[model samples]
Target: MKKIKNIRYPGKYGLLWVIALFCTGTIAFAQSGSDTTDTGMAEVSIELKYTEANNKTKILEAAVKTKVEGSWQGANGVAVQFYRNEAAPEQLLGTVTSDNNGVARMILPEGEEKNAGPEYTYIAAIKNNERFEDTEEEITVAESAFEMTLVEEDSVRQVHISLQTSDADGQEIPVGEVEVSLFVKRMFGLLPISDDPETTDENGEVMAEFPADLPGDTAGNLVIVARIEDHERFGNLEFSRKINWGIPLVIDPEKDKRQLWSSRANAPVYLIVMVNSMLVGIWGVILYIVFQTYKIVKLGRSKAAADTV
Candidate 1:
């Protein structure tokens, strides 16, 4: 039989390998804090971003990003709530949950915060079964002016009423469907007129018509009122103008006649004629100066020659 080499026992080496693995696992568990009690949970970090498409109107949108450690991924079912402010009647905008990537989004409407101040403060809350967290942000609404234009034409009485609507920014509010009650009686107490209720246009404009037929309405003063929805009175988003539709009426066929002479009497024609005359006069003066200078030089040369003789 061949001499057998001394061999290390397989059982002994296997026992040593098992001990090394156990020590490595214990170190990892201690460092990572893998064990958790019912009260102890890892803290989650969340970030929020806010943006608005219309700054003038009270419309806002918010996006949230949540990040929890791999160990505490089970608590991601926490409900997220979006609130306007800390008041008792704080408006709840929206709510969402974290996705696998831990992101949530919420969009807030303008009407929700109608009663809110010109400047609005927003807050977001993230809550689990018991743990809760919140963050706050502030936004402002930009005030805007109203645009008014006369939509109808009346050459006879020279009476045209224009419509005006207010907007926070450029976004036009739907005024066409809005009921606008006209208070012509209250405005012009003496004037005799029928109903003056009118609807606004998509541009938030309403055409208030002044009838040509009025009961002895000879340049009489008039008043108008506008109301929308349940609002008792129309918001003063524009300046008011007083008007008397009737005036000194004159109908002259000669005055209405189209004449070339009358058309040329405009300021533009007069300006053009003045400019052409000035240019012609300037050129004539320049030519006259050049001719005079040439004559003087020629005469001086002739005199010098005669003197030399």
Candidate 2:
């Protein structure tokens, strides 16, 4: 009975307990709602777009954009990284702070220089604490520049001699219907001949034959004189050089004749003589036969005259 006297009003105690439970439940619900709201916010996303405006100088222009989806928003001050496949990894191109629309624009520097083929790649990234998220885009580097080189061969004949030309750029130039001519000293004298020329083709090449009549007995040394003019273009050029036309004789006449006649039974000259003599002998035999026939006729005539007497 004494311990029961210390207990306060039961209704008051029950009211306190009910209030405490309500407060605890409200706190729990508020925390869960806050977590749901955080999840509903947008997440950070990045995109990259690029274009190759001028390929000759190896230049590229790129546009970078940052976006947010769901619940996680992009943090301030994001960085973009540009990289080439064969180059060093993860280079920071530039940095920008995201705007209210959650987009960032950036221009990346030119990538490492390369030859011929596709050369570079790009990526956009945003750093959150110690973690980073990035988006990748590829870039193509075009071929190298164009170049041309010309090489002329030694002219074998007296015709208008021309060089063989080619372009490293691989562009074909028209060469047909072009004028080609040459002037050189006469084989026997030191007279300068003019008006030798040739036109080039789409391949920057020309081959013209010279009408020089080189004698077999003269020395094979001659001066080459040439003038090349592009009738359709603005360039006119002249070239002259001394070239050796004398080629050494490879065959010995006596040796060649001996080899040629080795299989024959008679010498060529002896065969001709024998054939001529046989023809003459046949003619002589025919003459003798005619003389004998005439003599026999004369004898018969004489015998007939005696019978008549």
User: Could you estimate the TM-score for every candidate?
Assistant: 0.28, 0.25
Residue lDDT tens for model 1, 173-228: 44444444443333235332336446556665555555654322334544432333
Models, CA RMSD each: 25.9, 38.2
Top-scoring candidate (TM-score): 1
Judged by whole-model lDDT over C-alpha atoms, candidate 2 comes out at: 0.42
Residues 1-309, candidate 2: write the lDDT tens digits: 000011112343555655664667767435323221122211234433433222222222223332323344444444444444422344555555555544555543454443323223444443331222233444432222222222335744533333332234644334445454454555564443444444555554455554345422234555554544332221223355555553423455665453436546434666667888998899889999999999999999999999999
Error of 2 at 173 (Å): 17
Residue runs of model 1 more than 4 Å from their true location after superposition: 1-39, 55-77, 87-90, 130-309
State the local distance difference test value for candidate 1.
Answer: 0.44
The candidate that wins on lDDT is: 1
